[model samples]
Target chain A: MAEMNRFTRDHEWARRDGELVRVGISDYAQDALGDIVFVELPQPGRRVAAGEAVAEVESTKTVSSVMAPVAGEVVEVNAALASQPETINRDPFAAGWLFALRPVRVAELDDLLDETEYRKYVEELSR
Target chain B: MLRTPLFGAHEHLKARLTEFAGWEMPLSYSGVAAEHRAVRESSGVFDLCHMGRLVLEGTGVAPVLERLAPSRIATLRPGRARYTVILNGDGGIVDDVIVTRESDTRYHLCVNAVNRERVVDLLRKTADGGDTRVADLTLETAQIAVQGPDSAELVRPLLAGADFPAYMHTVRGEWEGQEIVVSRTGYTGELGVELFLPAAAAPSLWQRLVEEAVPCGLGARDTLRLEAGYPLYGHELTESVTPVAAGIGWVVDWSRSDLPARARLERDRKAPEQLLCGFSLSAPGVPRDGFPVFLDGRSVGVVTSGNMGISVGHGIGMTWLPAAHTDPGNAIEIEIRGRRIPAVVEQPPFYTRGTVRQSVD
Candidate 1:
């Protein structure tokens, strides 16, 4: 309803699209992940609650789970990113969209902080 | 916190810090997986100054070590090094060390830093043969290992393209107005070199090499050794352990006729109750130290070293399996966080891809 950008403290981002929101990991998340070598995405049309583990991305040395940003139904998947996941490192904003969701509630995304607050959240994590 | 001579250089390079065996050392700056892959594909540099070095001098140095160690030491030629274990009276291991014959009657032995105090105590007790003198020189000396497939090529620049010779061999080289003993040896299972130099010269040499090549840290060092199946002390060895149990009896010279007084231990040559073997998980689970290993639903062994093998692309570990379950190719399970994960047994020297032995074969 307001600005389209919403971010999670864990460094995930969700963008409002009609009744749906497209979700993916943030640049800070990728930097911490170091070169991602594998991705296990959530199945399309599956229902996921907020904070639920929706997917997993493993770099060469670390294996981390991606949490859902808001309660939602998986609408579409980035099947191409599974084969060319380095896109997450190259063009994280565009080619790295991990998944799309038909949000169960529009107001829940507002609970996520804005970009500036998200930046501070990540800065704390680095320390 | 005791700092190595290269400590300032590590900070200058923006290296990530971690606590390892009571020393603050660089875990990585170029990233763990990146540095690991560099060692596999080319070369990487490591600051290993925390290791302890002890020099023994006198007429009976060889005779004293003959009784103190599990192997015969008199056979080592001048400038040659041999790996052996300093065993306690009951045949239990104290520490596995590399003793270099510096001269006909002098020796330079490298011991584990964490075990330095205890090792020195043992050395003092065993050095009472009347003619032997032991000097703890760890604080004055430092060591660095430059390892990988292209390590010889990179080190050639310093030595004018001279070959590293063979394992357990050392060559004298001069750098930064310092005389350094360059050894054609390393913990990583690759064609590598170890430089023993004064502590002050360590930082400059570390930066100079990394400025022109790759700067690695403890993370790469651990993973590279794991990939090579070389056992870390805390992981695969301890005071109560024996070399035969860990699968390193090859250094014991069991068949030599001139066996020292320590040869009395061979009477009970039955391998220990637990056997050390290589293991890889069936799934994506990290089996850390102290994780119990099982066979047919019963606990039979424990993981001593575990991590993701970046070069081979799998989760790997070293485990002390009961001799009954120690056969290679056998299936075992590691209990990671209360979950039993499947693993396969493998022989040692795990990642043999770019090792020096590969060249001869």
Candidate 2:
């Protein structure tokens, strides 16, 4: 759990680091997707641009693309959820993180969303 | 988003809703795999209120119907339903329907939800018999497909001593004091019963079946039908495609010299270009509609319908291919996210072991 974090309306989270921000799918994404049966992770060393499709997680019924929030280098991944996909639907925030990053720019969090803003964004989607 | 009569019931049970044929339907309530397996091994019921039903009455019924439809309507006996395609004069399919001749003058027609209005309009204009009349009965009626290996066994307890035959058959029976039309037919290739009853009685009927033999949503219904080698309307069976090309040549009767479409269907025999084939992926990939299908590095066609086969417990799919490579055991590839994964063409009802037709002694 890091401070000054932001979430995209499309259900992606980013936490600011020194020069890079870590990225992963948000709690709402996993909840809507149900139990994640399979996940095709982005290559760890590759660079991804903002709004670009970087990964895929497939449930039994549908397969969804996880978009990159900010331009970044994928440095880490949650391999635990790769094998145990139920963790995503059960506990999406802590143990069920999708992937992390070595961001191209940390200030891009300004373009992302804070906790209150993200909550309102998710609220509008439900409507 | 259009809602079915059972929409409130689905919400109450906390079902996962998804858009289907312009109507909001439950994908699953508990789990797709669980519901699918339940229907395969035991029995499960589906709320089929979204499908369209129509009733036609008055004299000259068969004559009015014969002009529009490609099948011979005059040959149908009372209380018997015949599956036919209403063809465009040039010989393209409009939609597939089950027309039951209730009497010499009265008839009942069932059409898919998407093409219900289109089918009715086609019949209205083409039907020239002055004595015939048509009325849309979709809202007034509701049907439930209680299907599986144990479908007949479990539903027999509910019905009052009526037996049904194999595919494309129907029987009338009573359930809970209301006379019901119980048909031994279903889209899923299983020996199941489709119950046609009143609209108001649907919720209770669904409740009883769910309590008795596990309630199934559209998710299981889809997977079950796909595994059964049945062609869905928009996907495998389309207006642009003929029944012969869709792996359902058995439904088309070419012996009738009176029907002009017989000559049109024969033209396909001289030069058959597209052929439907069944596919299976051994590793881990589920092909979907619009996904590219390949054979020998050439893109032959696209996937029609696919899902995890509950009986076989593997990913199975159907796709159209060039007749040259449509043979069973021919190697093909499905382009899954740009990766050409190897697959093989297998004759469908991908699960070989199911009791669709009871053995006759």
Candidate 3:
């Protein structure tokens, strides 16, 4: 069975498939950022703590950081985004996934917000 | 927050709004990149009512303006416009403006929004003992700009009995019984016209033009102007920057004997310590304002304005560098987010396929 998705306050979303986790920015974050012009993804084999910046997203208006939602070691990065950053704007959930990580602490998954809580939190921010 | 006449129109289009110079204005409509491409490929209409407009009339207006600005206003013929700069006693630029000679004794001045009140106050103080009368018409007037290759085709049918004026020329015409001033002047380095009409007529005019052209916003405006190498008010120009160092010395009339900052400008004309130059990055990151520029690993300058040139497809910027380092082909680096990206100085107008000088006939 596929693990359910979780979110962080910084707008990053993570989905676990067995021991590996896929991370990307939420749709709300991409919509607020307008057109994504360039993105700098973290290198594979790098380790990051929760809430640490692992990538950057630049738009015509400004630049924003894509933080790690949980402590993990990066296993693979989305190499296609370096040439086509707009993918994140077009498809923030599936093809736009930034990287896959192997979590160091499996128990930390419970600390993230689920879909229901993330939806409520995002609604409050828009208001 | 201040709102222009077309504020409702922008809202109807679902534009992303942002605060600019105390006014709530559209930053983009559909998207910044798409709007920017529209202007380059075809035409785009912009609501520029947020800019300040002032009218000066009376027999001595020309002389009064000549005294307050560096341009030779007295020599400007009717229906012609001159781009000039207001200067302080120390040769620092107070503001850059476009003065249009409507008649022998009447002139129209377009200034930056942030500097409107200051310019009006200075003009009033200067006209105190003179025959000129200064009136601030910013609130009552609405300004619109139609720019790009297809601008003439888009605007020609809207007016009656007046041909599109030559570059830097102005003409008066009637549109639906309302009188308007049309000038063949723009900041986008494209063939374009600026329309100055009453505020009440702005919304309908904007609506009509939007039917034929893409509606652009401030986000695209900034990118377009940067690609054209135009100097923005607070960026490339400032209270401490003189026209000589800003690479716009031609606008200053050095032969005018009684100009306010003529002597100081002449003294600094030969060897300005720093000069404005254009550069493009070889790396991927975008160079932004306040980014440090380096030469041989030593910090030498700072970027004043920068963007990912939508047309050029690279990172482009303008910066103030020492006189010796302002030449084209000179290699430099811009420090962005603690990483030094390789760059090279180049001639301005990074996107050179502009149609601003193309003849309409």
Candidate 4:
């Protein structure tokens, strides 16, 4: 099965998994925030709209928010981040996923950018 | 923006550059946390060329320094350095400086980069009628710090046969035919040596030292000093706040009557209303500057300096509180992002396993 990833302008990535969607920040986001020391995740079963801040990532000197990519009910969150926040800096795409959500409107995923578009967007931002 | 002589060296090391105090300096090389740990466990090197350096010469230098500062300066022995502050007429701290008596008529002062021009102008005005000469050497010189438990071992081979100065003392030596001054003084609570050399000779020396020592930046330096309980100039020590409120009144030599802020300092020393105090959060949270501090649900003050206590594995910071609430074990709340964190007023030096006074082989 091929995996699909859609990105938001805020640098979060939402991957569709049939009825559920897993969310995490992109590599650029993790790199910008060096050496993550702590993470605050939203509680399971909480509903959030697109662009709502659902999680927080803290570095040695800065704090950044992880926003929800689309409207959904959070089903699960990665609890391991409480003890090992650096996991985000190590594997931001796979094991560092923040939470899983059951989307209220799966069609909203189409509004986000694909891998190619996100790469171009990031390049333009750096310039 | 002003660039240091070692800016090219920092770029070569892929440092994260940022603007600070009108200078483009490196904020971190590898990572702030990693560099901080390196200084604690092994060794680290830092480029401090952005700081202001000054040279004062002539017989009038001693009198001018004694009059402008609260600490005794005229009788300071050669090769000794004392941490003191320049004061305004109102007894407020103008700036914190390290005054090193180089000779009977020569002195070296390291000041904060942001206040360089102000300090130099003030000194020149005060010395107009005297025979003293104040020279701003900031642009012509460079300073580098090698710090940690293994600092001495790393620096000993470079200056072979030269006597290692005791803590708070300075030693003059030659490195690779270039003149240099090594001082056993640092902001971090570690066994460290700060090297003062000519600007043109800085890159080569920095490259040589970085081979064995982790190249650090201002990020780690800030955390290291905070853990050591040292106050930064603009944060804890400011023009409006005197040394008495900042918990550094001991720097004042009260017996002397010729000090500039003698009367105001004495009155504040005798009856202080509020004083700077240190605190640590009961939970794991990062506190930041300007965060409001509360006592019994009433706002008392704001955090002057705060950060994640890297060595202690918690949050630590400093703030002003009522004189009665300045004691250790008092409970307070630090508001972080609209959430108040339960904290307790504790004595500073939040991380105490330092090797500043230890002997290294």
Q: What share of the true interface contacts does each candidate keep?
A: 0.16, 0.16, 0.53, 0.37
Give lDDT: candidate 1, residue B188.
74
Best by lDDT: 4
TM-score of chain B of 2: 0.93
* lDDT, residue B357, candidate 3: 79
lDDT tens digits by residue: candidate 4, B1-361: 9999999999999999989999999999999999999999999999999899999999999899988898899889999999999998898888999999999999999999999999999899989999899999999999999999988988886665787778998888667898799989898899899999999989899989999999999989999999899999999999988887788888888788777777788777878888899999998788889999999999998999998878898889999998888889999999988889999999889999998888644
Candidate 1 lDDT tens digits, B232-315: 887788766677777787767776564443443464356356777998877765666677888988987678888767777667
Candidate 3, B145: how far from true, in Å? 1.0
Candidate 1: pairs in clash: none
Q: List pairs with backbone clashes in candidate 3.
A: none
Ranking by DockQ: 3, 4, 1, 2
Candidate by candidate, in order, the iRMS in Å equals 3.4, 2.5, 0.9, 1.2
Q: Which pairs of residues have clashing backbones in candidate 2?
A: none
Each model's lDDT: 0.79, 0.76, 0.89, 0.91
Q: After superposition, how far is residue A38 of candidate 1 from its true place, in Å?
A: 5.7
Candidate 1 displacement at residue A110 in angstroms = 1.2
Error of 1 at B167 (Å): 1.5
User: By lDDT, highest first, what's the ranking?
Assistant: 4, 3, 1, 2
Which regions of candidate 1 fall more than 4 Å away from where they truly are?
A1-5, A16-24, A33-48, A53-65, A73-102, A124-127, B160-163, B255-271, B283-286, B290-292, B335-340, B358-361
Comparison by DockQ, 1 against 2, better one? 1
Write model 1 residue lDDT over A1-127, tens digit each, in one string: 5645789887788988777888888888887776665566888989999999888776655667888899889989899876666678666666898888888897898899888888788777778
Residue-by-residue lDDT tens digits, candidate 3, A1-127? 7578899999989998778889999999988887777888888999999889999898888889998888999998999988888899899988999998899987787899999999999999989
Every model's TM-score on chain B:
0.93, 0.93, 0.98, 0.98
